[model samples]
Target chain A: MFEQAISAMASVVVDPYLLGLIFATTILGVIIGVLPGLGATTGAALLLPFTLTMDPVHAIAVLATIYVSATFAGSITAILINTPGTSAAAATTFDGYPLAQKGEAGRALGIAVISSTVGGIFSVLILCFAAPLLARVAYEFRSPEYFALTVFGLSMLASISAGGAVKNLIGGIFGVWLSTIGAERVTGIERFMFGNYELYEGLHFVPIFIGLFAISELLVQSKTVDKIIKTVSMKAVKLPTLEDYKKIWKTILRSCGIGTFIGVLPAEGATVASMIGYSEARRWSKNKKEFGKGSIEGIAGAEAANNAATGGAMVPTMVLGIPGSGTTAIILVGLMVHGLRPGVYLFTEQVEKVYQIFGSMFVANVMFMLMGLYAAKLFARVSLVPTQILWPIVFALSVIGAYAFQGQLLDVWLALIFGVIGFFARRHGFSVAPIAVGLILGEMVETNLQHSLKMFDGAWWMILTQPLALMFLVFAFLGLCGPVIFSWITKQKD
Target chain B: MKNIYLVPLILSIFSLAVIAIALQLDTSPEMIVGDSMQARSFPIFLMILKLILIGILTFQFYKNNPKPVALEKYHTWGSMFLFLLFYLLTVYTDMFIGIFVVIFLMSILWGERRVWVAFLTATITPGLVFLLFDYVLKIRFPRGMLMNLYYG
Candidate 1:
C-alpha cells in the first residue's frame, strides 16, 4: 500500500497535465467557495461533467481538490462581507467579521487559511490510513451486514434534514420511491414507467443532481435577486507569524480531529463539524470572552474543522459506498460516472486508484493553501459578481451539464422538472440533502435486502445470527428515531 | 391562494396519486417467488409514509391556519412562463441559441438593463460553456438549424 501510494505521489508530480488541472480546479473551487450562494455541493456538481473528459485520476483529483479548497474559500466571504459563502463558513462569521471590523482582516484570513489547510491535510491523512484498514474489515460484510449498513446510511437522514424529522424523512422516502421508477433490475418488470421510454432506465443521478442543486438554486435565487453588499475593501492576506501559530495551534489540531470525527458520520458533514469545532474551541479557550468578538481561535477552529470535514467525509464515501455529505454524494455520482465502484472490491481491485485519490487530495491541499495564502484578495472579488450574470451562466451550465451525460434531451427536461421540484422543496423548508441521501442509498438498500432475503430463504430472524448487522440495525433505528424519542422524554419530564 | 397551507394540500394530493400508482404496479406471485419484498413494496411503504406526513402537515396547517405565504417582489407566473418557454425552446432550437436567448431575455425581464453587459454575458457565457462540450470536450450538443449549415 505504501509503495503504491508512493508511486502515485511520484506520478502526480511528474504529470504536468494533472498538476495543471489540479491547480486550475483549486483556483476555481476557491472562487466558487468565495462566492456567496454557491457552496461546495453546487460547485462540485457544476464541475462534475467537466471532469468527464479527463482521466479518472485527474478527474477525482480535480473534484476532490475543488471540494477541499471551496470549503476553505467560504471563510473569505464570511469574514469580509459577514455573509458566509458556504453554510460551513457560517460559524466563521461570528468572530471573522468582527476581526475584519477591527482592521485585522488580513490576520484573520491568514489564520483561517492556515488552519483550514492543516485541518484538510490532517483528515486526508486519516482517510489514507483508516479507509484501507476499514476496507479490510468491510470485506467481511455480506448481504445482511450490507443491508444493515444501508439502513444506517439512510438513518443519517435524521440529522441532515433541516425541518421536522417527519418532514425530512418524508422527503427521503419520496426520493427513494422516485428511484424505484423504471424497470426493476432483478425482476425485469416495468414497474413505474408511465409508458415513457425515458422512464425505462430509471432517473439518472447526475442530471437530477444538477437540476436539484444548481438549477433549483438558480430558480430560488432568481426570485430573491437582491443587491449584493460588497462594501468592505479586503486587506492583504497575511501569513500567520510564528507567535500567531503558537497561540491557536492546539485548538486547530483539536478541531481537525473533531471535524474528521463528525465528518466520518453519515450526513453530518462540514457545517455541523465546524459548528461543533468552533464551540469546542470556545469551551476550551482561556479567553472565552473573545470568542464572538475578533477571536482568531474562533476562525481557526471553524476553518480547520470545516476543511477537515471534507477529507473526513471521503472516508465513508470511499470505503462503504455511503456518502458522508451532500457534496460527497455528488462525488459518489462522479465516481460511478467514471466507472469506479466504491466498495470493498474497489479497495482490493483498485488499490492503485485509491492511492491515486489520496495523492491527488494531498496535492490539492498544498496547492489551494498556497493559492489562498497569496491570491485571496483577487479571489474575494468573485463574491461581488452580479447575480444577473451569475445565475444566467449557472442556468446555461445546468442545461449543458444535464444534457452532456446521455446526449439526450429527455435528461434536460427531467432536470428541468427536478429543478422545479427542488425549488419548491427548498422554499417549503424541506431539505434536499435527505432526498439525495435516499436516492443514493436506495439501490444499495434494495439490492442488499433482496440478497439477504434470498440468502436466508425469507427468514427475517437470521439477522440475529449476525452481530454486526444487528448492531447496525440497532444504530439505524436509534439514529432515525432518537431525536423524536428524546423530545418526547423531555416533554414528559416537563 | 398562495398560502402555506397550499404546500401541504399539494403534497397530500401528490402523495395520494403516488400511492395509487404504486398500488397498481403488478408484482405478481411468480415475480416474488423467492424474495419477501416485491418491487412495489418499497414504493408503497414510502408513499404511505409520505401520506402520513402530509396528513400531519395538513392537520397542523388547518388547525393553526397560518397566514398566506407572502412572496416578496415575486413575478411567479412570469418566472414560470419563462422557465417553460426557455426549456421548450432548448429542445427545438440549438442548445447555444436556447441558452443565450433564455438568459438574455430572463435577465432583462427580471432586472439589469445594461445592454452591452447583458449581451456579452448572454453570448459569451453560454457560448463558452456549450462550446467546451461541443468542440473541446467532444460531447455532443444540438447544432440547431443555424450552426450545422455553417459547419457544413
Candidate 2:
C-alpha cells in the first residue's frame, strides 16, 4: 500500500496535464470561496460537470484541490470584508475582522493562511493513514453491516437539523422518496418515472447538487443585489515568523485535532469544528480575554480547525460512501459520477486513486499557502465584485453545467425547478443537507436491506445478532438520541 | 406564520399518496432467485417511515405555535419572476442565446447600472462558455435559431 501510494504521488507530480487541472481548480476554488454564498460545496457543484470530460483521477484531483483551496479562501473574505465567504469561516470573522479593524489585517491573514495550511496538511496526513485502516475493516462488512452503516449515516442527519430532528427526518425521508423515482434495479419495474424516460435512471445527482447549492443561493442573493456590503482593503499577508509559530503551535495543533475529529463525525462540519476550536483555544489560552479582539491564536485556532476539516471530512466520505458534511457530499457525487463507488471497493480496487486524492489535497494545501501569500489581495478583491454581476455569471454557468453533462434538457429543468424548491425549503426551516444525504444513500440502503433480508430469510431481527451490525445500530441509536438527551440534561441543570 | 403549516399539511397529504402508490407495486418478478425481497418492500417501508415522520412533524407544528417571521424588506417576487421567465426561455430557445438574454436582463434587473456592463457580460459570458465547454471540452450545446442562422 505504501509503495502504491508513492507511485500514485509520483504519477500525479510528473503528469503536467493533471497538475494544470489541479491548478485551475485551485484558482477557481479561491474565487468561488472568496464570494459569500458560495462555499466549497458550491465550488464542487459548479465544477462537477466539467469533470465528466477528464480522467477519473484528474477529475477527483480537481475536486480535491477545489475542496481544500475553497475552504482556505473563505477566510480571505471573512477577514477583509467582515462577512464569511463560507459557513466554516464564520468563526474566523469574530477575530479576523477585528484584527483588520486594528490595522493588522496583513498579520491576521498571515496567521490564517499559516494555520489553514498547517491544519490542512495535518488532516491530510490523518486521512492518508486513517482512511486505509478504516477501509480495511470495512472490507469485512456484509449486507447487514452495510445497512447498519447506512443507518448510522442517515441518523446523523437528525443532529444536523437546525429546525428540529423531526423536520430533518422529514427532509431526509422525503429525499429517499425522491430517489425512488427511478426503476427498480432487480425487478425492472418502473417506480416513479412519471412517463419521462429521463427519469428512469433516477434524478441525476449532479444537477440536483448544483441547483441546490448554487442556484438557490443565487435566488436569495438576487433579492439583495442592490445592497452593498462594505469591505476593507488588504494588500498582502505577512508571513508568520518562526517565533510566532513557536508561540501558538499548541493551539494550531489542538485545533487541527479538534477539526479532524469533528469532521470525521457524520453531519458535523467545519462550522461546528471551528467554533469548538475557538472555544477550546479560549479555554486554554494564557490571555483569555484577548480572544475575541484580534488574537492571533483565535484566528489560528479557527482557520486551522476549519481547514483541517477538509481532510477529516473526506475520510468518512471516501471510506464509507457516506459524507461527513455537505461539501463532502458533493464530492461524493463527483466520485460516483466518475464511475467510482466509494467505501470498501474504493480502498481495495481503486486504492491508487485514493492515494492520488490525498496527494492532490497535499499539493492543494501547499499551492494555496503560496497563492494566499502572494495573491491575498486578488482573492479579497473578488469578494467586492457586485453580486448582481457575479451571480448572473454563476447562473449562466449553472445552465451550461447542467446541460453540458448528459446533454439532457431535462436536467436543466430539474435544476431550475429544484433551485426554486430549495429556496423555499431553506425558507421553511428545512435542512437541505439531510435531503442530500438521504438522496445519496437511498439506493445503498435499499439494496443492502434487500440483500440482508434475503440472507436472513426475512427474519429482520437476526441483524441484532451480528456483532458489527448491532454495534453500528446501537451507535446510530445513540447518535440520534444523544442531542435530545444532552439538551434535556442541560435543561434540567438550567 | 398563520399559514406556515400549509406546506407541512400539503407534504403530509403527498406522503400519504406516495404510500398508497408504494403499496400497489409488484412484490416479485419472474426472474428473481429464491423469491428475493421484492420491488415494493423497501419503498413501502421508506414511505411508511416518511409518513410517520411527517405525522410527528405535523403534530408538533400544530402543538407549538410557530413564531411570526418578519419577512425580509426585499421581496423576491421580481427576481423570482425574472428567474422563471429566463429559465423558460433558456429551455425552449438555444442555450447560448438563452444565456445571453438572461444575463443581460438579469444584470439590468439586479441593478447593474451600466448598459455596457450588461452588453459586455451578455456577449462575453456566453462566448467564454462556448469556447470552454464546446471548443475545449467538446460538449455540444444546443444551437438555437440565432446560432443556426449565423451558421447557415
Candidate 3:
C-alpha cells in the first residue's frame, strides 16, 4: 500500500502535465466558488464533458481538485461580500462579514486559509487510511447487504436540512422511478421507453446533472441579473499573527474532527458540518459573546470544517458505491461516466487510482492555500462580474457540456427540459439533491433487491434473517424516522 | 384548494397516471421470472410511496396554512423562453450560431444595453468554444446549412 501510495504520488504530484491540469482547474474552481451560486457541483458537472476524452485518473483528478479548491474559495466571498459563494460557506458569513466590516478582512481571510488548509490536509490523510479499510470490510457485503445499505442511504436523505424530510423522500423516490425508465437489465424488456431508441439506455445522468445544477441555477440567476455585489476592499491577504493562531488552533483542530465525521455520514456535507462546527466552537469557547461579531474562532471553525468536508466526503464515495453528499454524488456520476465503479474491486484492483485522488486533493489544498494568500483579491473580483454577462456564458457552456457527452443533440434538449423542471422544483421549496441521490442509487437498490430475492427463492422478507442485512435494514428504518422522533422529543421538552 | 395544494395535486395526478401505466406493463415469460419482482413492480411501488408522501405533504401544508407566493419576474420567464428558442435554433441551425445569437439576445433582454460588451461576449465566446472543442478536442459538431454552404 505504501509503495502504491508512493507511485501514485510520483505519478500525480510530480508529473508536470497532471500538476498543470490541477493548477488550472484549481484556478477555475476558485473563480466558480468565489461567484455566488456557482458551487463545486455545478463546476464539476459543467466540466465533466470536457474530461470525457482524458484518462480516467486524470479526469477524476481534475474534478477532485476542482471540488477541493472550490470549497475553500467560497470563504473568500463570505468574508468579503457577506454572500457565501457556496451554501457550505453560509456559516462563514456569521463572523466573516463582521470581520470584513471591521476592516479585519485580511485577518479573517488569513485564519480561514490556514484553518481550511490544515483541516483539508488532515481529512485527506484520514481518507487515505480509512477508505481502504472500509472497502475491505465492504467486500463481505452481498446482494442483501447491499440492498439494505442502499435503502439506508436513501433513508438518510430524509434527515437532510434542505427542503423538508417528506419532500426530500418524495423527490428521491421520484428519481428512482426516473431511473427505472429504461429496459430492465436481466429481462432486457423495455418499461417506459415509449418506442424511442434513446430511451433504451435510460437517461444519461450527465445531461440531467448539467441541467439541474447549472441551468437551473442559471434560471434562478436571471432574477438577480441586475443586482450588484458590494465587496470589502482588501489589497492582499495578511497572514495571522502567531498569537492569533494560538487562540484558534484548538478550534480549528476540533472542527477538523467534527467536519470529517459529519462528512463521512451519507447525505450530510460541508454546509451541515460548518453549521455544527460554528455552534460547537461557540459551545466550548470562553469568548462566546464574541461569536457572530468578528470572532476569529468562529471563522476558523466554519472554514476548517467546510474545507475538511471536501476530503472526508470522498471516503464513502470511493469505498462504497454510495455517495457521501450532493457534490460527491455528482463526482460519482463523473466516475461512472468514465466506466469506474466504486466498490471493493476499485480499491483492490485500482488502488493506485484511489491514491491518485488523495494526492490530487492534497496538492489542491496546499495550492489553493498559496493562491488564497497571494491572489485572493483577483479571485474576489470575479464576484463583481456582471451576472448578465456571466450567466449567459455559463448557459452556453452548459449546452455545450450537455451536447459534448456522446455528441448527441438530444442530450441538449433533455438538459433544457430538466432545467425547466428543476427551476419549478426549486421554486416550490424542493431540494434537487435528493432526486440526484435517488437516481444514482436507484439501480443499485433494484438490482440488489432482485438478486437478494432470487437468492432467497423469491422470499424477499427472508433478508432479515441475515445479521448484516438486518442491521442495515434496522438502521434504514431508524434513519428515516430519526429526525421526526428527535423533533418530537424537542417539542415534548419544550 | 389553496394555491400551494397545486404541488401535491399535480404530484398525485402524475403518480396515478404512472401507476396506471405500470399496471399495464407486460408480464410475459420473457419479462417476468417465477416469483421475483418484475420491472414494473419497483416503479409501481415507488409511485404508491410517492402518493402517500404527497398526502402527508398536503396535510402538512394545510395545517401550516402556507401563503401564496408572488408571481415571478418577467425576466425569469423571458430567459427561459429565450433559452427554449436557443435550443430550437441549435436543433434547426448551427450550435455556434445558436450560442452566439442567444448570448447576445439574452444579454439584451437582461438589460445589458452596452452593445460592445454584448457583442464582444457574443463573438469571443463562440470563437473560444470553436477553437477549444473543434480545434483542440477534434470533436466535430453536426454541419448546419451555413457550414455546408461555406465548406461546399
Candidate 4:
C-alpha cells in the first residue's frame, strides 16, 4: 500500500500535463468560489459533462481539485465583499469582512489562505490514509450491510440544517422515487417509463444534478439579480506575521480536526463545519470578545475548517459510495460517469486511482495557496462582475452541460423541469441536498434490499440476523432520531 | 399555497397514486419465485414508507406552525419562462440562436438595461462556448433550421 501510494504520487508530481490541468482547474475553481451563488457543487455539476471524455483519473483529479480549491476561494469574497462566494464561506464573513473593514484585508487574507492550506493538507492526508482502511472494512459488507449503510446515509440527511428534519426526509424519499422512474435492473421491467424511450435508462443523474444545483440556483439568483456587491480593496495578500500565527495556530489545528470529522459524516459539509469551527474557536479562545470583530483566530478557524472539509467529504464518497456532502454527491456522480464505481474493487483494484486523487488534492492545496497569497486581488475582482451578466452565461453553460452529457435535447428539458421543481421546493423551504442524495443512493438501496431478500428466502426479518447489518440499521435509526432523543433527554434533565 | 402542510399533503397524494400504479404492475410468478421483492415491490414499499413519513411530516408542520413562505419575484418566473423559450428555440431554430437570444433576453430581464452590453454578452458567450466546447472538445452540436439553411 505504501509503495503504491508513493508511486502514484511520484507519477502525478512528474506529469506536467496533469499539473497544468490542476493549475488551470484550480484557478477556475477559485473564480467559481469567488462568485457568490456559484458554489463548488454547481461548479462540479457544470464541469462534469465536459470532463467525461477525459481519462477517469484525470477527470476525478479535475473535479477533486476544484472541490479543494473552491472551498478556500470562497473566503476571498467573504472577506472583501462581505458576501460569501459559497455557503461554506458564510461563517468567514462574520470576522473576515470586519477585518477587511478595519483595512487589514491583506492580513485577513493571509491568515485565511495559510489556515486553509494547512487544514486542506491535513484533511488530504487523512483522506489518503483513512479511505483505504474504510474501504477494506466495507469490503466485508454484504448486500444487507450495504443497504443499511445507504439508509444511514439518507438518515444523516435529516439532520442537515437545510430545513426541518421531516422536510429533508420527504425530499430524500421523493428523490428515491424519482430514481425509480426508469426500468428496474433485475427484471428489466420498466417501472415509471410511461412509454418514453429515454425513460428506459431512467432520469439521467447528470442533467438532474445540473438542474437541481445549477439551474435552480440560477432561478434563485434571478430574484436578486439587481443587487450590487461592493468589494474591499486589497493591495496584496500577506502571509500572517510570526506573531499573528502564534496567536491562532492552535485554533487552526483544532478546526482542521473538527472540520475533517464533520466532513466525514454524511450530509454535513463545509458550511456546517465552518459554523462549528467558528463557534468552537470562540468557545476555546483566550479573547472571546475579539470574535466577530476582526479576530485573526476567527478567520483562521472558519477558513481552516471549511477548506479541510473539502478533503474530509471525499472519504465516505469514495469508500462507501455514499456522499459526505452535496458537492461530494455531485462528485460521486462524476466518479460514476467515469466508470469508477466506489467501494471494494476501487480500493483493491483501482487503489492507484485513489492515491492519484490524494496527490491532486495536495497539489491543489499548494497551488491555491500560492494563488491566494499572490493573485487574490485578481480573483477578488471577479466579484465585481454584475450578477445580471454572470448568471446568463452560467445559464448558457448549464444548458450546454445538460445537453452535452448524452447529446440529448430531452435531457435539457428534463433539467428545466427539475429546475422548476427544485426552485419551488427551495422557495417552500426544502433543501435540495436530500433529493440529490436519495437519487444517487436509490439504486443501491433497492438493489441491495432485493439481494438481501433473495439470500434469506424473502424473509426480510432475517436481515436482522446478520450482526454487522443489524448494527448499521441501529446506527441508521440513531441517525434519524438521535437529535430528538438527545433533546428530550436534555429537557428531562432541565 | 405557502402553508407548510401543503407540501406533505401533495406528496401524500402523489405517493398514493404511485402505490396504486405500483400495485397494478404485471409481475410474473417466475420472477418472484426466489425473492418476493419484484420490480414494482421496491417503489411500492417506498411509496408506503413515504406515506407514513408524510403523516409524521404533516403532524410536525401543523405543530410547528411555521410562517408562510413569501411569493417569488416576477423575475424568477420570468427566468423560468425564458428558459422554456430558450429550449424551444434551440429545438426549432438553433442552439447558437437559443444561446444568443436567452443571454440577450435574460440580461434584459435581469436588469441589464444597456442593449449593447446584453448584445455583447450574447455574442461573446456563444463564441467562447463554441470555441471551447465545439472547437477544442470537438463535440458537434446538432444543427437546426438556421444551420441547415446556411449550409444549404
Among these predictions, the greatest TM-score belongs to 3
Task: Provide fnat values for all models in the order shown.
Answer: 0.54, 0.65, 0.61, 0.69
Quote each prediction's TM-score: 0.95, 0.95, 0.98, 0.97
CAPRI-style grade of the A/B interface in model 3: medium
DockQ of 3: 0.71
**Model 1: per-residue Cα lDDT over A54-127, one tens digit each:** 87777888888888989999999999889898999999999999999888888989999899999999999999
Residue A277 lDDT in model 1? 94
**Worst ten in a row by lDDT for model 1 chain A:** A226-235
Candidate 4, superposed: residue stretches over 4 Å from native: B30-33, B149-152
| TM-score sort, best first | 3, 4, 1, 2
Q: Give the TM-score of candidate 1.
A: 0.95
Residue A42 of candidate 4: its Cα lDDT? 91
**Candidate 4 docking class:** medium
lDDT of 4 by residue, B75-139 (tens): 88889889878878987889889989999999998898899999999999888887787666767
Task: Calculate DockQ per candidate and list them.
Answer: 0.58, 0.59, 0.71, 0.70
lDDT of 4 by residue, A154-187 (tens): 8888888777788898899899889888778877
What would the per-residue lDDT of candidate 2 be over residues A188-253, giving only the tens digit for each residue? 788877678889888888888888888888887866666778777665689888887886899999
TM-score of chain B of 4: 0.88
